[model samples]
Target: MARFVLVSDTTLSRNYRSVPLLDFLASAPTDALPNAIYSFLKGPPPPAAEGRAALAPYAVRKLEASLLKHYSKDEVVVAHEDHISEFIDEDTEVIGVSTMDPLGLGPLTMSYAVFFETRAHAYVQREFESLLARINKARSGKKAKLLVGGPGVWELTVRPEELDRNKIDFAFQGEADDIAGDLFRYVSDDSGEKTEFFRGYQTFNANFRKEWEPNPKFISRYQFSKQFPALEEIPDIVNPSVKGMVEVMRGCGIGCDFCEVTLRPLRYYSPERVRREIEVNVRSGQSNAWLHTDEVFAYQHGRHYVPNEEALLDLLRAVMSTPGITRTNPTHGRISIPAAYPDLMKKMSSIMGAGRNNWIGLQVGIETGSDRLASTHMPNKTLPLKVGPDGSWSDIVWRGTYVMNKHYWRPAFTVQVGQAGETPEDNWDTVALINRMSNSSLDNGLPFEFTVTPMQNVPLGLLKSRDFDSVKLDQSQLAVYYASYRHLAKMAARDATSASSDTNVAARYVTGALVGVGGWVMFQQVKSICRKGGLDLEKAARHGLSERPQVPSIAVIR
Candidate 1:
């Protein structure tokens, strides 16, 4: 039997506990055919399996189907680095390296110290070098082919010269599930034309199939589990509700110039399928459900969007009617619904006890208020104002608070900014929008907690096209945006202070405005230097926001 070995750059010990990579490799159907599989998980396994159960059933199902179809189950083996050499015998025919890289999307933690302290890019490079060293050592007298795949290998930053120097035989982008079959066919061939035969082997198509199988169990077990590994560790405030977490769809149709979700074709799960999954989770003792999707309202089956108003209402009624489960005391405490479609928002609010102390909250992507800037940059998002009668935008804060006060007695919202293709005009519009929202919140007597996340775009795949220039922060733009943000923050602070006492109202407002203006001046200074340095606005923003460590030491890999 042909022997194959799989190696991952990720610390297997730290990240792969619930549905370990070895589990997938071990489940492959290699023995039924002519192969023997041995998988080695490099690095530390993940801490715990606390949060993995939250992934929707549909995702988990897909992952399992793919694994079973590829490699033989009994033929597979798993080990760490210390035992890697023991598995690499002369019979080994292929060595596959599963390398993943961080996409430079800021720190996983919001803490500034952790953000700058972690060198994700450097960590990736070291991992690659280490894998190459292992491959070279294992190559003693065996004629095994070396294969590399994963997120890190697909980077525009990785130069061809580096690959050439390392002498990697082949690299797979996106997915590597089908690589084993192709490698098996190539190695088993007696003809010396093995290279020629393998050159045309369908790596991309095979990998895609292996990656996109429709097993709900696999998707539930892998991605979701890994994303929130320790389920039990989560605070009760954020714990799963009675219904449990369920994914309504996958992928997004909106091709926001700055976003990555648009790169893949959008595929949605059916409402009927969603209902079935919900029932499964409830039966399995899950209380709350968070519907996961890039755009929840975009879910369409065949000719129509599933759970369109009437259908969603029916689904909610059915859940509420489930014996012994009250709509108010749902097994799943809260459902985090997306505000992509205003109609969906209205429907969700109406059925889930809108304008009351309801457990559900809506997440709307109000990227910016400026119609022109939003249209140019994030065209995929339907502007609230652009939708209704006479171009009237929805009062999100008011509605959010209304719902919270009526149902759950808590107000929550998430606001995102710093899209990849944002321009000076776009930034100005964002500033204006923030100010307007903050003011509106106070005027309407709404208690809302706004999370302002400033994310700089990273160039990747098709998005690396030359049409969109990278944003570099110039002194002027920086000054303007910072001033605008500070102005809004001060306004919020003043509003809070005013609601308490009237004496410091004037002083607080004046001080806030002055601090905002001063920040603007500093921004101008930085802009002038950026212009002299011939930097692009996007690039400048990345440099300014990137956490640059003082000593430039490599991250301490555990």
Candidate 2:
């Protein structure tokens, strides 16, 4: 029997019809989104090949590669979720599961919970529980130690009771590429000094500083910088990853006060390293390279966070030169780069072959539009451009969107409400920014293409207490939600049909129809919720339209 069997939570295994951003559907409450629709959106599970997953999530694949460095191929198996039972036998010593948002306490999941006023478990949490039940059942007679890791492990740290509730032996809290071999050995042996690992997980205080507390059920890196794997220490994937996903870098140095990613030291992957991973995905018939990073602009950055234009271009060139990469886009980036460097945006778009038929999708965290909040929370996000000298934070975002849309790039923006020191006016500024962008058109007369999602700034105390129902959206927060959904419905109706990547024409049309209809229905529900919360819908719809300035397009600026 395989000694190490790695798997990811079920929510991460599906292809999601190859539609961009459809994976977010798992964050919705299982009660709110019927299982039929969820399954249809997630598409079929990856085909099982000899009881092994045909494709696994990128993180699980990374762990598998790490384990392979110390174990034989037959001793390590990346089991498909449905076929996990086939791999677990009497000799299995460790079963490692990686997940994201296992408890539905993530920002988006919590936002839905608070806005919808439902305590129902999100599809992510539901799937994780179901997977654990299956795993526990299969390993009943065996001595396989269950170890959970990944971004979602932090949630378990917040709610330690879940370790006992789910029958998990240990929850690893940090990146394990450097220590995977020893970690597995430690668990398998079950007796050691434990000097290499911290028995507790790391958490952030109210001011967002790192803090560690004792917990026998959790383990974190003893020394973060020393334990974080270096660029050469990390390994390339030996198996195909879902979504053609590959990491170009490890940390975001933008240092947003509210973000934890900044706390980790930056480690960039060389272009050769990136190309090798893309080649692995290409062999699996994945043509689209989804580059994963906290901030694409920070890759090989120059002083003061100014994007290294040449390095960025070289990276895209490496991706495009891959044998089967038809399209490419980074997972996250800051808008300030596009605002401050239009030529670079055009150059990168050309490298990626972005145009009307192939719009590059990017996720940008435009947390708030108010200059006060932007400067207060994420001062470095506006690097290379001062808020007052360049323009307001919203102005920078507007110019960035203008530049991106001109080059056929659609940004999926995420805004936050209920910040630590936020006032109603701060939220109104966010509404105004969304309205202004929604009503504005491109230089080519095409309406600006983008989608905005409002996420609640949920506190750790609330999440740990599992008191999500006690959270309520005030009038201003509700206005942000209404404004956000209003624009989302428009984008869905306009782009859903064309955005699908499904090979079957009939399936694509069906998926598009459902998406369009679902958008309208969800907006109606959001409207009702806002009205009950005493928000003025009409005012929100027209918040900044009248004051939108006719700024010159970025094409002529530089």
Candidate 3:
């Protein structure tokens, strides 16, 4: 019998491109496909490589090969999460859950999914708790330690009560890669010091390393050897994460104050390593990839983190030459990439044969427009540097947007509401920037697209002590929030998602309008309902969010 059962939440189990009806209706096209055909209407996303079938074999290999010396490959089982009860019985000594959001703190979970799914956060929480309950029920009171780790571990660590109630043994925050082997040993030999950033279940009383550096343990370990998973190892059962996922590098990777992984030093994998990972995915019948990086252009930097054109272009060329990577989707980039290397940006676009197609959508962080806020929360976020004649934030945003669009890359921005020390002037500035980008364009005929997430002061972020309840939204900030939802919905229709694989784009606009008018009132209901752990948003909306317009009425406007 296997000694451990490892599984991620529902998000990682599906195809990366697979944005289901609920998830799709809330945002731009699923994964924003550059190719016209597969963007949507392709049908349900094929299962992700992390699915029970696809990933179990990989876990076995990783465990037996080297990652785990305490157990054989045969001792590791990747059970279908929904059928967790069937596999997590007496024989299972440890249950390791990998989730992105256990308490529904993610912006996607809070800002977007809250409207249609109604009480969405609570629903997601129930689903997660139910899964945990399944393990407990199957274990039948036997001592199978429950280990939880992921980007969302903060949601639990922030509230120790949840960990105790759920009986979680260990919770590891930040990147879990470096400590995976050590974690395995903790289960196998039951010996090891408590990890630096990681805490035992009841250590809620223990303070973070320091106050200003809320999540200091999140920093990267320069000495840790980065492991590249064999394409065979991290399989997706439902659908692929569009091509495959390959981490090109990590460091100062965006440095967004609200991000779980921030303030990290820059590091890049050798081009040879990147190429091999891509080849592995190609061999596994998957082409293309969602390149994981803090900044694409920051690849192979020389000194002081300046863009190295040769290194950046060489990495792109290596990825392109990889037998089958047609579409290249990056996780996040600063508005400065196109600013610093306009010529190389166009060249890189051409190398990928994105001749004139600007549909290559990327997640860019433009958290706020106020220079003061930018300098305070995330000084390094602004691309091209604000010195000399480089242009102002507005200029960089507009110029970068124009440059990137010209090269066929559709960039979707991320704007936050509860930034540290945001003033009335800052809110107005944010709205003005949103308006400016809206007028400029989200795509050819589309307006700018951005998701406005309320800044929750989770334990791992710089503002960990900042309370979400205290971060109230003023009228100007509320206006920014409303506008962001409407524009993004419209961008979805124009984002080229098809009916073949996702919800009709027309419905997207309708839902957007409902949420567009819902404002913070709707968001509060989402939180309130979540605290109550209920899934019926309609009931919550009616009783708590009475001001929210009915979806049917919004449909008429559409």
Candidate 4:
């Protein structure tokens, strides 16, 4: 038996059929989606060899690598969820699980709960509970300590009692790349010394400010400087990660008031470091590189949040030049960068070999379309391009989408509802933006290739009480949801067949068909909900079509 066993929640272990953005399906409420379909869509778990997962989530892989620096390969095991029992025995000193959105109170998960009007646990929460049950069962008579950590650990801090309910010994917060060995030893030995660590977790306020509260179930770095590991301190993954993921950067410097990612200091990985990590994934038969970052454009950025085009280009070139990398794309970025630097986007697209058949997908947080909200919540998001001087927030987004589609980049946008000081008109603005973008096309007559997902800003108090039904979506909010779903349904019907990554022809076709039909059916439900909520679907259908911008002539490869 291994001394330290690490695993990730089931949702993060699968490939989601390798379809872009399909991973979001795991956030759907258990009561809303059927089990048969969910299981099919999530695909099979990663292959295991002697109870060890061949590919694990990137976060768990990082933790595993950190432990390996001190522990021998035989002493540490990254176990598959199904075979965790095989690794746990009396000698096992600690069982570490990495999770994202374990409690399902995350913005996207809560969005579904509020929209669906159900308090049922999301698939994430359900799978986490089930995994905990399995772990507890495996370690029933053993002396192993259950340690849960990762980005989702914050949810546990919000509901600290869950630590006891789940039989978790400690929920660690913040980055532990530099101190993983110390942390493991502390947990394994049940240390009471608070010299390098604290006995509490950190919380963020409405303004995204950090606060600490005393809690024995939680452990975190004592000093803020210790929360983020410097570039030299962080170690590379020794194994392949799910989706061929490799971290390119650590924090987003945009400083969006509503975001906590901005709190961490920025750290960029050199192009050489990035390529080394990609090589590890390639050795495991992954040809596509998924660069993980809070903001891709912020890599080695200049003053005033200006994008360093040369740095970004070098990074892309390095990724593509890797031995087995056939494609590459960043995880997240801001729209204003693409809007203000079209030439840079075109150059990067050429380097990545992007085209109609090879669309590059990115997740962007265009939280709101209203300029008032944009200026108030995330003024720095539009750094290089001022809202009034360059264009309205919607206009900037429109031009950015146009440029991206022209260069074969499809950004997945997330908009938020119920933000601080949000008004009905703000939601209507969002609906109008979605309608206009959905109706616009590229120079090659291809529809704008992108997706818009609506997220809810659930208050902490409500999240703790599980009183989601009390937070109802008004008519305008329902309109935003309707408009977003309408556009998503159209995109699904058009791109599902082409975007699927399954190698088997028959399986790919079936998966595409299911995805397309599922989108239409989901949109129908949204339409019914909107009709019952007193939203004017017809009016929403034509909300911003009258103001659709004319497509400018541009040489773009289809």
Candidate 5:
């Protein structure tokens, strides 16, 4: 009945409500018993007393409105997750599904295989397959085309049969705004057949690489300025994750090698535009929100990643001064904004929460600690400083951490384990940095408190040569890997005992004990490695194994 039916995946549709004990275990039936026990010990789902989580997916919401403006009334219809059946009838011509990661890649991959080891997010994969089934249900010889796109669209291409079996005709990777009209036209034409990848990415030759690489074409600021969705455009919130998710800006001009943001050009909304969006959110009943940006601190940055402190302050004032904005958090950002301009950090933190709870969850990319590695891999990550000469990577990192701690900001630190062309010294140097942060204590406690994220390489960025599993780590790297888990495990323990509203005492207590013990065991092994002066793989390989009793083991968790 329509030109194209647009929908979001289950991961995006449902508000990210915390899973119940049984719900969490439903992901892995084989390990359900253990997962249940684990949930009971670590963190149990809140009793049904907590109501259903609800919110709209920002992408789908924006796209639905954008496409709505472009198309006539009967030509387009936006469907919610629950009402998916109504739109997938015989008359449906095209289905556009948006997802962050349809496959078990990125954070979800690490969650089950590495962190929990309990097959978490199995529901995500199943939901993806379920979406395919829904799309296929009305295909009584109708042959409606299926198109998928999003942050993790490339992950699906790795498994070619998924595209073929699912009848996925095209995947519009990166920003597809420019080609939306073309897609609609192609779908309308009965004779036209689409390729598996986007037109721009079709030329990417993945013949020689170990993985399928899709070259994404970024929309420059000159061509694509972001247009915020109008208030009335937002449909009812069926499932909600976080309130007030506004797009303050797009693209990180810094061009970090590992991130997808660098591939695009930098552009932002005016303060008035930002305020208008905030007022819309307040009217819609979302008091708190995490502003979506590749790099929030880098908003209004000039050609060389320079900070426009006054402009930033004005923008923050506009956001914070809005009638009902209780909390404002950044989706992701670089460290230089706070490190270079400490005053801004203090002012921003004060505006968000000056007197009461000042804790804010921020995503910061502190990929590696090795100076040479930082220089070679992500030179522009820290502004105005070339690695080794201007300031050592460690110093820059330490200073940033100190500044964050001083301002009472708790950041979620993303640290990569194994990267291409990294030496053993580079690995050890990273471990040493983590150790220093763990050991640092000021004013009777740790100046900086953060959850360490052990990031693995994905096919999305410059290092798309191999899958995450292909990464090999030496003993020192293993120590660092376990260290992150251990640190987080301890934090989980504290959360279990803490007086937070969502804290599950029984589950967190059990999880804390398990993680604490596991971390302690890892610590003991690491201590022995430290006694032996860490992993000297080259020296050990050069010397026969006949001399050393313990030949260090590498974990292959594929």
Candidate 6:
């Protein structure tokens, strides 16, 4: 009988590491391993879970599935890391290492210093190299041929050029469902058939499918508390709220130029299936559960859209009617209620307990105030305020504030600037828009926070066709961007300070106007610097600056 050992590169767990070893072992032929051992690096448990869960059962079940498909169940020996020290014997002909964790750098660190000091990318590289060295040394001079596989290996080894400089005999690089039969054949044969085995592995590099099957022996490492239970104890980890996570669907349909989720076909769960899952979790005493999906709002059940005004109200009513159920929230994707669909937004608010101290908060991506910039860069989402022919800035602000106060209490909005393909005019428009929004929030006493996150767009996929030289910022434009950021910070701080003072209405309004005027002056200064440096005027405007130098006679807009 051939002896095989499987080592997990990182701490063994379900969420982080995706090596389905249990399924593989269960399906493999019993003759593949008369004696076998499994080991894990065994790091501290997740910060929230407290590390009490044993990942061995889950790994074993995956291995068992593969073993049962070919070999008898009795042929495999399952041993944990602690058990391996007592059973290190000869005749171990094959050693398979699960390189999923090490390669992906699943939130674990080797040293306390490195964990705190090093960047994520550097730490991942270091851990991967270290794991590779360990595997090499362990197999040194042994007759056993070393094998590596896991999620990370699938990506790294799909192309032979991407492999480590050191030779790895065989790498199982895909969903290891049916791949185990092929692996068993390769390990059992004495005739060095490595080339033939790897050629079969190449199929994953071209095309693949993700298949899921229930493993009976699947065991969780932690025993969840009855009061504040962990997420894993409840079915899946898709859209999990306090109640449980229910998978609304798998994959996405939108082919956004920057997204990876759009690569697969969208598969949605039926409403019946959703209700059943919810009932199961709620019966188990979960009050708050999340509906997991890439886009929860876009969930289509059978032929109809879920939780749309009528359907969502019905789902909420059903969930509320359930015995002892209190709340339900989505644990995935930002919820956006289109400006044109204010009635729907109002309907959602009524159902999901929106308003003061409610669990639901609308997360809308208002990427930029500039409609033109948003349309050019992030075409997937560009919703602007609808204005009548004679509508003024005040009209827009008043309507926006009215919408926020009427529909929801906590409305989280995101704005993006400095995206690739953004011109100087686009940047100016963003700044002007932010200024208007901030003023409106202050005037109306709405609880809002403006998060300005600057991102440098990297050309990938469809973006490769764009001319980088034309869109790329010159030295002056770059300097203006930096200056604008500092000015925005200062303005925000001034507003905060003014809002804190307990002054008369007139005094408060005067202070706010002064702060606004100061901000406008700083904006003009940045614009002047850009002009002197020979930067594009339109680009400078988009950054929230004017071409004219700051003059004492010129009055700042109130």
lDDT of 3 by residue, 1-558 (tens): 667777665444444233322332222222222223222322233343333444322222223233344456557666666666656666677787766567665665444332323332333455467678777777767767787765567666556467778766666544434355655656544454444323232122332222222332222222233322333333222212233667677665545555535445555687777777667667667766667776776777655556787887788888888877776766667776676657877777877777444356666777776767877776666644652245556556666676677777766676766555777677666666655565554336544433433322223342244234443444555555545544444444444233112234554444343333333344454445443543333332222112321111000000
lDDT of 5 by residue, 1-558 (tens): 676777767655432222211122223322322444433432322122112213446675555545555676466655665555566666677777887766556542543343333334455565677777876675546756777777767665555456767667666655545445455555445353443223333223333222223333211111122322233333322222334677787677787665556656666777777777667667767777668887887888766677777778888888888988887777787765666667878888887774325466678878877887888778888775445554667667766666677787766777776666777677666666665565554455653466675655434442243343444445656555655654655554444333132334554444445544534554454345433545553432222123322211211111
lDDT of 4 by residue, 448-549 (tens): 888999999988898888777789899889988999999999999988787578876776887898899989999998999889888889998887677655
lDDT at position 205, candidate 2: 79
Worst 10 residues of 2 by lDDT: 549-558
Predicted structure 4, TM vs. truth: 0.97
TM-score per candidate, in order?
0.49, 0.98, 0.72, 0.97, 0.74, 0.48
Q: CA lDDT of each candidate? A: 0.39, 0.89, 0.53, 0.89, 0.57, 0.41
Per-residue accuracy of model 1 over 7-33 as CA lDDT, tens digit each: 554332222111111111221122211
Order candidates by TM-score, high to low.
2, 4, 5, 3, 1, 6
Shift of residue 271 alpha carbon in model 6, Å: 4.0
Model 2 TM-score, all chains together: 0.98
Q: Which scores greater on lDDT, model 2 or model 5?
A: 2
Root-mean-square deviation per candidate? 15.8, 1.5, 10.3, 2.2, 8.9, 15.3
Give the lDDT of residue 395 in candidate 1. 32
lDDT of 3 at 153: 70
Better of 2 and 6 by TM-score: 2
Of candidates 3 and 2, the better by lDDT: 2
Q: Which has the higher lDDT value, candidate number 2 or candidate number 6?
A: 2
Worst 10 residues of 5 by lDDT: 549-558
Worst 10 residues of 3 by lDDT: 549-558
lDDT of 6 at 181: 51
How much does candidate 6 score in TM-score?
0.48
